[model samples]
Structure formats: C-alpha cells, structure tokens
Target chain A: MLITGIKSRPVYDRLAPMASGLRHLAIAQGSGGQPMLRLLADMTPAQRGVATVVYSSESFTGNSYEAELRAVDGIDLRLCASNVEALQVLDDLLSTAKMGTRLYLAGSEGFIGTAMQRATEYGLDRDEILREHAGSFVRRVWCAHCNAYTENVTQRIFRCPGCGLDLVVRDHYSSRLAAFQGVKADGEVPGELPEIEELDT
Target chain B: MTPTAEPTAFTTDETYTPEGAYTFRNSREGVRRLPFPFPDDEYMYSMNLEPHVPAGDGAMRAAFDIDEHYISECHHRAQMLEAMPGVHYLALPHMMEAQWDLLELIFESYARDYPEHFTLTKTGNEWHWQNRLLGIDDTFTFGDPTTLPLEPMEYATRQAQGEFVVLEERDNDLVIGAGMTTQRADYSLRFNLGMRFFEFHGPVPKLHEMGILDRALKFLLRMKPGHPVRRVNWSLTVNPRLETSVETLPEWAPDRATVDAENAGERVYLRIELQPLHRLPRSNAIVFPVRTYLVSLAELVEHAPDWAKRIHRALASLDPELVDYKGFHRYHAAAVAWLAQHDDGAPLATGYPWAEGGIQPGD
Candidate 1:
C-alpha cells in the first residue's frame, strides 16, 4: 500500500581511480564492462599496472562489453561464465587480499549486492569501495516465508519459485540479504489478490 | 466538530481492566506514567530526543521499566516465539560481545531499579540471577551461550519487557546485528537484520530530504556510554495487539477493515513506543529497547480528556503519506472522524510533554 516512495535502494557511485590506493580490484558483470573499461582508461599507467579486473559474461539484458574489456592493456582481467562463479572468485580473492586494496563494482543490483556482502565480510570500509549500477533494475527478491531468493524479478507480484506461493514484492530492500522483500501476496485474505502492476524499477 | 459537552478534567478513579490477552488495563498510575507522544496539537517528524532521566514524579524512573503488565507481556512474547519458530529473533556471529553487554545491562538495570523483583550476583565468570516476578533462578557462565537455554540476547529480552535490538557500530554506521522482536508494529527482524541505520529507516517519509537521518546517524555514532538518550515514536493500531510484525501481517491486517467511526473509539489504540538508546560499555554497540504502550481512544476520552483532544488533533491533521506509512491508511478517516468529537479546537500551550493538565519539559 505504501510502496510508492522507497529510499532503501543504495545510491551507486561511478567507478573512478582512487589516487591513494596502491592496488585496485574492479569486478563487473555483463553491461558493467562499459564502466570497467572507462575506469581503466581513466586510470594512470601505474594504477592500471597493479589492478586486477574480474568480469562475468552473464547478463539479463544480453549486453556485454567483453571484447572492449579484454582489449584494455596493463590490467589483469579474469572472466567468469556466470555471476555465481564471479562471486566465488571474489570470495577466494578477498580471503587472501591485503590492506590498501580498493574495490570497484559495476553490474546489476544483484551483482553489486552480492559483491558488497563479500566486501563487508572481508571488513572493507565504505571508503575503500565504489559501486555503479548498470544494466536493468530487475530486483533480487528474498521470500519471507521460505527464506529463498529469486533473482531478476521485474513484477510487483510474482510466484515464489522456492515455496510456490504468490509473492508481492515490497518496496523495502535489505542490503544484508542483498534483495527486496517478497511476502505471500494473499496472506491477509487468501485467494484475494491485489492489482498486478510492473515494478517502477 | 462541536465543543465538548463532556467534562474537561481527568479522574484517577477509573480503572481500565484487560478484556483479552492483548488488551491492557491502565490504572490511574499507569495512565499518568504513560509517555504520551503528542506534545502539540499537530505532529511532524523531528529528532525529539531527550535524556533518559526521570521526566516527572510519576514518569519513568529508570532505563528498563517493569510494570504490572510485565508478566503478561512476557507470556505473550513466549507464545509468539513458539508459534513463529525462528522467525522472530536473529543475531550475527560478530555480535556475541554486544549480546552479553545487553544481557548484563538488562540484569543490572532491573536489579537496581526494581530490587524487590530482580537480583543479580556475580562471582568470577559465573553469575547467579533470580527473577522472582517470573519465577526463575539460574546460575551460569556469563559469556557462554551453552550455559543458557537460549542465546544471551534472547534470554535477556524474554525475561525483560519490550522488544530489544542490538545495533553494532561498523563502517561508520550502525547495523541491526541482533534482535528479539515479537512486538513490532509492522517491521521484521529477519529482513532488517544487518541493515545500516538509514537503510532500515528508508521507508520513512520526508526525513531523508531534510537530512535528519544523516544528522541523527552522526549523533548516534558519537554517543558514549552512561549518557543514554530516549524518544517517543507513535502510531495508531487497530487494537491493543502487540504482535504486529510483517511476518504475521495476515493475522492482524484484517482488523483494520473492521474499524469505523462508530467503533473507532473502542477499537483503535494509540500505540506509543518508548525507545531508549544506550551505548554499550564493552561492545561499543548501541542497544535499542522499544517499550510499547497502548491506550484505546475510549480509555483516553473517558479518563484523560486532555490527551484525547491532543491525540485527535495530531491524528486528524497527520499527513496522508504518514498515515499510510504508519499502516493506518484504511481506518485513518474513521479514526479521525471519531476523534473529532473530542477535539473542541481549543488551543494547547506551546511547550511539550503535556500531561493530563499542562505542558512540561518531559517531552
């Protein structure tokens, strides 16, 4: 009912060179390659030399800058087939990563959220990270009943793949779960559903 | 709206007896001690913070309050946890220290404030606690979770009144790391846990643009131990129901449709949350305790007419966005229509924390 104005969504930052950072780790997915390419072009030769870039080819919109990202020089690029594999790579990298490393994330909201969750687990400060939202705003929703997550949701109401209940996605977002809340749509009065509409996102 | 044909003065003789498990009976002392949220004729969002000290003779005397409803409220909380399973409580692994800090704070405060009901004695790492009011006696290692039936935060909050959320300070923000919240108005601990201060408060209207959240976060981050602060936030509920979490929305939301102008006075309740924030000494975290109090419109107009009028003005003029945000949109009109009978359009004094009589600094 009160889903019109939501401020819980994170305001993304553009990927830019942090002059003081001795090392950089840029992670992106699908359409996010454009920003990653631009960031590499903006970086000085010294900054690019010590940077490691990770990009996943998986995308919702089917837009990719994999060729342009690969042509960039001096930076080490690691490409993954999917977002899940890319996050796994990030977890392994951060486990052995040290201080003075700055993280840059550009991709879908789901990718950024998963990336930030890893960054938090690694004790990365907000100052050491930059996230730019790219691609579609298709939400990653967490079902309240089954504690399950459904990715790339574009509708206000949809059926939860986990519990099979019709779920209404609330405007409320949680960075911890890296998703919006999806509760049983007809929990109040079973079989009486609210009007269906596309999400403003 | 017409001028009052009823008495303007309040009477202490009336006793509001509980009609059900969720309903409360406010005695004369209870009515006076209530931290009524409306300090003016109208309402708007503000910092509204104050020291956690006593506001008046009958006002709250300590951080944790144990009233006549303590036993019943605790019983209600237990029932909720049993029904919901693991949905109502959450704590991250990194919040262990904060959990112990909260447990200690609750025990020490309860013992100090209400010595006749609670006591805590410590010898080395082992501690002995007795809660005569709830009939509990336990001795265990303070920091060990295996020593207790539940986690430290859950055990302490189960024995204590109200909902408690432990906010861990990290990365220049407070995160909802742990909570025992069975009595929330329309929020969920499972969804809110691990969210930054502003992230969880994102649904609130207008305050973000005014930079209130930014300013409030900076202020809270700098809060030191022993200098706690308190504020009173309010909303209207359909009944005196306490288990209003989003997890159980289906169970309670239907009550909203049952309200109308005629039954609004007896069915609607002004739900007040007495939130006190304390910076824990060891964990360097903030323990947020929300103590809820409910007074039906009928109870207020019958015993405390001044409060009834003030609440009427506040609700009648509330912003539509706020009415919706408070989850009272369906019955907002009906509640306002009923309250209009009490509001005579009389002018209230400009100061805040108005009692049955006049304004005080208590707000």
Candidate 2:
C-alpha cells in the first residue's frame, strides 16, 4: 500500500516497538540538541543497538555522546553548511539502506519531503512512503481594509479583530486527519466525544 | 568521493542480518491513541525505558524491535510529507536552553536558504519563525511593567524650641508598594522562543527595610554615659499608586500612534500595596526580575488563519530534513491521543481535535 498523508500514522506509532526488535538499532536525531538524546535514553534500553545523529548549528554543536551514536549508525548528525549539503547526506544514507527496509524519517516537514524524494529516486516504491506533518499553520483573518478571505463564503461574516476586515476562516490542516476533520459539513461533533479544554489556545 | 573504508567498532558482540524487514508489520489494533496528557496528572501518564540487552552480558541482542519501528515510522512520515506540497514537520526542544545552541544552527540554515520565505521574531517570551510571503502580521500583547519598586518609606521627627522643654515625640513607620504594567504588542511569532521573568516582590516584611531608633538625654545637665534613653512609639502606613503608567511610559513616537489609538491610549497595568508594621527591622532590600515566556501558536493561528496555514505548510514541508522525525511524531500523536481520551465537555477551536472542547487536565 502506498501510505501517504493520514495513512502513515499507524506505521509511525510502531517505531519504538520496531526498534526493540532490531539486533543493532540505530537512532539518529538531526541537530536540535540534547533533549532528543535524553528522551531516547528515557525510552530505550542502553544495551540496545542505539546510535544517534546530531547536526550542529551556530547555536549548538552536535559534539555530545548522543551525536556520536548518530554518526556511527550511518546517519549524518553534523550541521550542514547549506540546504544542499543536508539534502545530499540524507539522500546518500537513505539510498544505501536495503530495499523492503523500513526507514523512519523524523524532523521538519522540509527534511522529510527531501528525504522522501531521494528515496523514491533510489527505487523505493510510493507504497513505502508514510508521513506526519508536525507544525501549526499561520492563520490570516479577513481585514476589512485588506479584504482577504472573500474567496471562501463559508468563512464570511466575521470581521478581522486585528484590522476589522470581513473575516473568513482559513483551514491550515498540516496532517491528513486535520484535513479530514476540517471537512465536517454540519456542527455535529465527531463520535459524540466529550469537549476538551483548548490547551493550545 | 566514495566513503573511506574504516573498521566498524562493534559496541556489542551480537550481529544480525538486515533481512526480515517484512516480519515487522503495523498492527492497527495494537496501537493506542489518546488526547494530550498533562504533566500534572501522574495517574494517567507514565514513561518507561528498557535496555535491549541485559547489563553485564558479554553478547547482547544487536537490535531492539522498538528502535527499528521508530526509525521506520520516521522514514514513512518523511515520504508522506514529500508528497504533500508546502507542509513541514519540526522536532522540538529546538530552543530549550540545553539544546538552544544546536537548534539555533539548524534555524540559521533555514533562514539563510529561505530568506524570503522565513522571518524570525520574539512573541510573548519565546522565539518563532514564519514565512514572510504569507504577509500575516502576527499580533501579541506586552503591557506588563518591566520594573517595579520594592518598597517606599516616610519619616517624621520633632524638635523642641527651648532647652528646658522635654517634649515626647513619635515616629511614623515605613510602607512598601509594588506596581506592574503591560507594555505593548508585537508579532506573536516571537513568543515561541520563551518568556522573560520580571521581579516579583514576595511579602512586604521580607524586604528588610523596617527599623526604629532608641535615644536618652537629661534636660538640665550634660548627659552621662549609660543614661536611660526615652523610647518613642513608631507606626507605618502604605499607599500604592495603581495608575502610574502615564508617568512610566514615555510620549508615544510616530510609529506607536496606531497601537496607542487601538488600546484607547492606555497600557495594561497591575499593582499591589504593602501596609507598614511597627515590629519590622531595617535592612538592605533587593528587587530582581524573573523572566519567563509563553510560546503558544493558538492565539496567532486564530487571528490570522491564512497566515497560519501558510506557515503550517512551510513547517510541514521541512519535517523530513529535521532529525528525530519519528520522535516528534510519537510525541505529537501521544499528545493528541491523550487529549482525545480525556476531553471533558468544553469549548475549543478547530484543528486541535483534543481541544475541541474546554476540558483540560490539571497541570
């Protein structure tokens, strides 16, 4: 099955269990920082074949023990001088992995997309692809002065609190589930689920 | 150049082939989903870790299934996002103090490569970035006072007109007061970085600025050593100025006219007063600011939906390039699932299924 969009959640959820099954498990974290390593240490056994990758940046250096693990596991954990360098290293390692092998891509959407393209070019089938988008959307309301969001009628009537523009609700669904949830025609709640406090708000 | 061949240092004695990739399958039923779980509720939340090989064992298992599964999932997510245009995923702890240096490097690369597309700013107390092409003016409120006085004092003394008159005198006690003000608003995206802590005075007596004096004297003759000194009674009073922003903030510049007009030319303000007590002692008082930030995207997303969508797409697109893609997925999923499982009936916004209602767990 060519898993993409929302279809990939099931696959992503099993990462920890799958890693446990490997004889020599390698975990790579791009150059965010030591938090990833601490999280990994808290989640996995030290005896597991665990390797980490860390890419250094101006604000951070991937010189910790966790970073070493990433390089040893055939992952590039150093800060790339340019986007091109980052794409190149990611492409090389992903392509070298054997076919039918499950590859886990974690990080920003841009990083995942680049790696996916490289993997496909290297002979991985579309069915082998799975993804989860991890970011919030930037919502722009209709400003009476700006006259934005006039295109979508369903979002009409509301005025921009910022600029008093005729506001229209814009959908910023990064994940397939979010997109699916955005499409409900009626006010009927999904599955009669109880309301949760808006923690993000 | 082909990679140089180097002897692989095996951390463990065990070795295994890369086959049986198909042996691991996604069991949908086995997976659990819940809404975002709060850190405060210890009963419903738990974290566990285990080693693949037993400690002190010479030859241990080469790999653990869970680790492989995490890697595979990360790869899958990357591919999925690649198919979707303008979406990105981000691994977090990006700017946590311990990880700030490394995350900053990654951010700089993105900024350099996509200068026109990305802009970084401080919102609330945190730092965040967004694609400038979206043309969304992220709004944030910052009317809190930056500095406040720890305490204020008042003193009174009485003098006699003639040398023979021994008039009794009393002293007024000291009083302390605190004030705070919300300053202004900026692009909300900056809040993602963190918050700055301001000085918050605790109890008034703790400030160490209260004291009294003892003196003794004879009316007709020169005073001798060890003469008894008359004790004067002392008392205190506190009056705090609540509306002090008018004097605190300087005259508005041409650029601030719009914001000042919007807020009725008034800044948000908060103040507290401490009444004086007789028994307190005199000591040096210290006032320091304690800073913190709130890095939430919800408010900005609500006000500027289109801009939020554009930034979301840009972030989604960048996911694969980031490390720990799998870890981010797990954390996000778990947060959503925990929210789903525990949501009580409350009003919430769209997109956040877990927060569709106002039922949030205690912190």
Model number with the top TM-score: 1
> Per-residue lDDT tens digits of candidate 1, residues B161-260?
8899899998789989899998887777888988888888888888898899999999999999999998889988877788888776766777888899
- Mark the regions of model 2 whose C-alpha exceeds 4 Å error after superposition: A1-14, A17-84, A123-201, B1-363
Which pairs of residues collide in candidate 1?
none
Question: Model 1 off-target regions past 4 Å?
Answer: A19-23, A43-51, A73-76, A163-168, A184-197, B1-29, B57-59, B144-146, B342-363
Model 2 lDDT tens row, B1-363:
111122222111111111322222212111111111221211110111122221111111111111113323323323323533222211112112212222232233334533544455656545554534323333222121121120011000000000010111112211111111121111110111111111111111212222111111112022221221121111100011111111111111111222221231121111111111111111211111111111112221333223223223322333331212111221222222322323333333332112234222222
Each candidate's interface RMSD (Å, one decimal) is 1.9, 21.3
The Cα local distance difference test for each model comes to 0.83, 0.24
lDDT of 1 at B255: 81
